[model samples]
Target: MATAAKKESKPNAGFMKPVTPSKILAEVVGTEPMPRTEVTKKVWDYIKKHDLQDAANRRMINADAKLEAVFDGKKQVSMFEMTKLISNHLKA
Candidate 1:
């Protein structure tokens, strides 16, 4: 009896495709078109750089003036909600 070879999983095409960020998002992530993964990374970088995460609750992200626009005027959002909010600012 022989063991079957493992199959590798490919990344989702949609996530890898380059997307343009809306003006509000561009202010945080820059104006260049980038993959969704990179956009998330950059957004997280900005959040970390600015110390925007809430001290009381690590999962909560406090929106600054620029981020408030991206977050649809929300003053604070959870880590999970952030991805959904950011999606609105990206276009294919």
Candidate 2:
């Protein structure tokens, strides 16, 4: 007899929960409540639209005027650090 395939697990509820963004972050992601995943997506969209990724280092992001505030005056941040910095601008 053939064995059944394992079922896929659902995403974490906490991750899907909505959170409001701070004023600075709102400039980039808009003034609306969204899950952390969506917030990250919107930020990425803005980054791509503005071509903020460093050409020399693809893993680094160069903050623009709006992003500068969100990044806490940071001129550049790594992709990994971007997530941590963005979290500081989010609130449940």
Candidate 3:
């Protein structure tokens, strides 16, 4: 019998900063230090609350003023792309 290779888990970068208000994002949606995952979730909540998701294509999020700053001034981005944008706010 052949042994299966061990799976390596992606390490958590570090303890995620607690979600709080941020400066650049202050006007966008109130800046804060949240785990990368939580930040996205919160952004999605804002999107859903404001109906920012595209009706024709749900993957794209229409950036609001707050999101625009976080997204590097991007007006729109896919769900996958959102991750990269959110990462910029995360601090060590």
lDDT per residue for candidate 3 within 1-92, as digits (tens), equals 54467677775765354655456654545555566556667677788999999899999989888788888999999989987777676554
lDDT by residue (tens digit), candidate 2, 1-92: 43457667898999899999999999999988999999999999999999999999999999999999989999999999999999999999
* Error at 89, model 3, angstroms: 1.4
Of models 2 and 3, which has the larger lDDT?
2
List lDDT for all candidates, in order.
0.97, 0.95, 0.73
Instruction: Please tell me which predicted candidate would have the highest lDDT against the true structure.
Output: 1
Provide the lDDT at 1 for model 2. 42
List runs of model 2 lying over 4 Å from the truth: 1-4
Better of 1 and 3 by lDDT: 1
Q: How far is each candidate from the true structure, as Cα RMSD in Å?
A: 2.2, 1.8, 4.7
- Residue pairs clashing in model 3 are 20-32, 20-33, 21-31, 21-32, 22-31, 22-32, 28-66
Ranking by lDDT: 1, 2, 3
lDDT of 1 at 75: 99
Cα-lDDT of candidate 1 = 0.97
